[model samples]
Target: MTTLFYRKIYAMKTADSTEFYVVRHGQTAANLQARIQGQQDTLLDETGELQVNCLAEFLKDAKFDIVYVSDLKRTRATAAAIMQYHPDTPVFFTPELREWHLGALEGRSFAELNAAYPLLMQQIRQSSFDAAPPEGESMLQFQERINRFMEKIASEHPNQKILLVTHGGVLQRIFNLAVGVVGSGNLRPLCHNASLSVFQRRNAQWQLAVWNNTSFMHLTSANDTITL
Candidate 1:
């Protein structure tokens, strides 16, 4: 969609509200193979490059005051593509915006992991609020991290437009937080690669303006929520 469309739909921003144009990073080989990426720093695959190119074109005319990107290869690449339009826009690379650190399970395919760690896989699939991969952050810890980062940014930049390039898990956490979902056992729509989601913070409250918008990509691909 065009930037004009975005402005029309989100025209409620006041002098104190903050707008967030959040984007999940493009695809990777792990995404196609159903592997857990976590903090692996995987590069984008061929299709991922094309997806981000389309996304960059779609957002080329959007105005952004600042940009926040996850300190990972996939997210960085995606952010780079989009920031080409706003060369002078200040960008911050932070690990706090990175994917849930799956630790030892970072490189394993879903089927392989399920075969070896059935109970853990079950917990992950069920979205057990406390379940975590070996040596990884639990669902609670991840949620806290995301909440802290979001609060910090919103407090720092009022009445400004911000662009956030992160991961699917982070997007999912943001959605959960916006909807008052404390724990797991709740179903969420899949966050496709290179999808765009928008949130607005007004009077210290965050509201979802859009969710899982992939119209720019022309096609949708695997998301981190995929499972066998």
Candidate 2:
């Protein structure tokens, strides 16, 4: 339950400006079971639902202009909880925002994957930018996918506060891109479930405003007995 928040000040505001409030979806069955999930769509468990509701309550005052979510079930559910209050606000579903395609690794427990392909798993953990897991997407491929999705968002909404519900891998890539950090060597830790990471656009550049603000975690814990 550590909350991290950062902000940058900028004077310029463009007519096509966009503020991205990125959120990782609530915990899924895969998360609780320590599975690779990847692009697989899983429904939110009871705790996951509560987590999203808490996040919705925390973000209710922010008044986002638009809500965007991955087409994946977990992310869609998370976005639904937030958009419930602002029924008038439009919600956009994008498949490009989906999690890294885990390929054959999808829906398998991490332990099982490692046990079956220990060396390959080791290579991935050691930095497998070019190497793809057995029928899985490479780290480089994931980065490219995230970049395309981000560029689309930039083009679609330039000057508006947007709420995005996506996955941990996608957000990590975005953090790296915004900070001018690239490559699989220096990946940021995965975002927490239902956590918010804010980014601001200024002078045609994206700046990281915050990284993994878990205020929602506190709010969720206040009313729920579950621990993640």
Model 1, span 115-194: residue lDDT tens: 99898888777667767778899877888899999999999988899999999999988987777777676445578888
Q: Per-candidate RMSD vs. true structure?
A: 4.5, 2.8
Tell me the TM-score of each prediction against the true structure: 0.89, 0.89
Cα lDDT listed for each candidate: 0.82, 0.79
| Off by more than 4 A, model 2 | 6-17, 220-224
lDDT for model 2, on a 0 to 1 scale? 0.79
lDDT of model 1, residue 218: 49
Candidate 2 residue pairs in backbone clash: 6-209, 16-158, 16-159, 17-158, 17-159, 18-158, 18-159
What residue runs in model 1 are displaced by over 4 Å at the alpha carbon? 1-12, 219-228
How far residue 25's Cα lies from its native spot in candidate 2, in Å, is 1.0
By lDDT, the best candidate is 1
Q: Provide the clashing-pair count of each candidate structure.
A: 0, 7
